[model samples]
Target: MSVAVDCSSEETADILVESQNSSLLENETEDIEEFFNVAMELAKNAGKVVRSAFSEKKNINTKLTGQDLVTETDQAVEKMLISSLKERFPTHSFIGEESVSAGKKCELTDNPTWIIDPIDGTNNFVHGNPCIAISIGLAVKKELLIGIVYNPIQERLYSAKKGQGAYCNNEEVTVSGQTELENALIYSEFGAHRDPEKLEIKFGNMYNIIMNGHGIRAQGSAALDMCGIACGEADAYVEYGIHVWDIAAGILIACEAGGIIMDPDTGGKVDLMSRRILCASSRSLANQLKNQVTPQSFPSD
Candidate 1:
């Protein structure tokens, strides 16, 4: 769990050279490991803040829509995470949910940047539910390099670095390898968007999955839902009207776990900034989901 970079050691350098996606030079590998370590530490500290504030009723404010709630704890946690991360990587940029709520820009750059959701399941957290987590994703040159999601309540830590395998609680994890949709467990989220047309599309997709798949779950947190797929707890996940922070970490985690994520609009390719995403335990299952379920365009807002 220690994030200390040891690329200087001959053994560490050999391992990186032999790993998947091992194209990175020694310096880049060291930089990425440093970032990953800093991010994991920040996520753990943020989890503590979340746990200490979970039991009490806190002030909540609406953002963009009534369904989107932001609590004082959310703001405080983001401030803490950003502050701590910035101190460690001063030149790197950050795009956090609270900063966006405060009218700051959410644009991503090709530089080393941190995409953070201080509390991914804010609504669930507000309701005293434990289905929440701190999602931290590190993107370098516009490519996700490291992802970490910590569910302090459940004490589940899911993380992955590009070219490295995915891990849950330090154990290597993988997708369920369910190729058939009918017998596959699926996960999806009803986003904050309440537009009737969008809602109809979401419900219709849910209905199709329900009648075809083994079961469907609305886990409230996109990060956790995708992590579920990464660890084989669920076979697939689909969502629309979500942001980069919501799915950034999950994308890397799922892919590192041997899962496939696609943009249904792009004929099954991936676009990180796409507001819509379809993911499954395997490439075959992803294709099945894409062909079986038609995607409807929603207001991107």
Candidate 2:
């Protein structure tokens, strides 16, 4: 499908091209536009740093538990981004995963804040896998307003603004219109560290889909998985245990791409910091999946 976008303003054009969201942000102040431009530039710069680190020796470390990992690249990129953003917008808040892991609480104030994951999918990066990203999201008054997710290896940049459409690589894209489970290609994340009972229920849901002739993928990056759905490459993506940074930008992209996002546990609109999520191309599919998965209960770990 073809999407029309105004390429008059360079900044708007760049965002439109990178995002493929058809709708342009209306009446944005020059300051907001400048901030977005800086964010996009910083995110791309961080991607370069990550690529350089990937090509050489990386100092890998563990976080949270043995299952979670971090790298020197993650910290360095975040520091660079935070510093640059602070230099430009000193009054703005910065919330970064690495910084948060270092025991810095990211409290949202009235000022604008940038939510960043300098190198998301550090596990993939550490393992020399290509499914990692740099996620940058902007929020004012704790409300998410703009977001950008870039995968350096793939050179795919997804972005969106509040009330505007989503985009990928300058093409206007939308979620697939597949309404049935049998026709859907779903993406999910499952790992060894997850609770066994939860795994069982998740497996049961997988089994139901398998019986319906649906396809399932377990790409490591949550940001990319949601982007995949946004670009209509995947019909849905669901994750039970994830943090806000993982899905923040992705949720905006998906919504602007005309997809539905919700908390899988409560079947409600997703809060910015929600831990569990169910995202689908359409509300019908989301409700169907939620219903099928709801009857099964998993023990909390």
Candidate 3:
């Protein structure tokens, strides 16, 4: 269950190999192993807190809009995570969705930071659906380095470390190798809040997929949707109006699992904070999906 990768330069290969071999039996020197262990533990603990408050009557507040919600459990779990992480790494930055909503601008710093969504898919949680999850990710200088998404309902854990493969419940996972759109099952989200004209264009693109591809699904949870793609449960997922915390962890896992992600609007590599996303098993399918939806046709108004 432990892996050692040589990312050193040719000149340093001898030293790196010696270091690797020497540390093979040691515990503290392995950053990936340490990160995986801590993340998995913290996520499971947070999941326990979330589950405890799931069915009970708790204070829920709307933020940004009525559709966006936060519950007492979110704050409680975030506080729990922050306290635990701070205890372990006091100098590291921390950003949580609820913490930011409270006016804490925890910017990504050069120092290691933890980006957390204590309970993603809060709307689903409020409605008693079990699709919600706890998303925890570690980023260094704004680049995702480690990710862990835990669904307490299913007791499933999806995790990844940069340059190391992704895993679901300790089993290595990879995106489907489906290269053609016609053989791929895609997942997407469609809603009424978006511009009608823009929606029409997206719908048209989706219609093409429905007719030509294997099928389409809208799972309602962005984190789960990406994880589904990461584990090859689905071939691709595209959506808009999602924030960094919603997709940050899942995106890293998807990419580490061999999936490709791009901005749906520009067909460029996705910025982690970008609101729009198009994730697919292969570059060709992603481009095929992108070509079907033209940004020019989408109204700017």
**Which candidate wins on TM-score?**
1
lDDT, candidates in the order shown: 0.80, 0.74, 0.75
Instruction: Candidate 3: list runs displaced more than 4 Å.
Output: 1-29, 191-205, 294-301
lDDT of 2 by residue, 181-253 (tens): 7788988776424667877877887776666637888878888898999899989887766667787778778
- Worst 10-residue lDDT window, candidate 2: 1-10
Report the C-alpha lDDT of model 3 over 1-301, residue by residue, as the tens digit: 0111112233222212212343332454376567668888999989888888888887888886676788889889999998898897788888788988899884665577788899988888888889889999886645567889999987889998766788999999988867788889999776324566767766887787798789999766788898998899999888766667778789878877878777777776565554677888877888887766545232110
Quote the positional error of residue 122 for candidate 1 in Å. Answer: 0.7
lDDT of 3: 0.75
lDDT of 1: 0.80
Candidate 1 per-residue lDDT, tens place, 1-301, comes to: 0111111223343222112234543467887888888888888888898999999878999997999999999999999988998888899899898898798887777677898899999999999889998999987766677999999999999999987889999999988889999889888888887888878888988888898889899989999999999899999988878878888888888877877777766544455565778878866677767765667665331
Off by over 4 Å in 1: 1-26, 298-301
Error of 1 at 237 (Å): 0.2
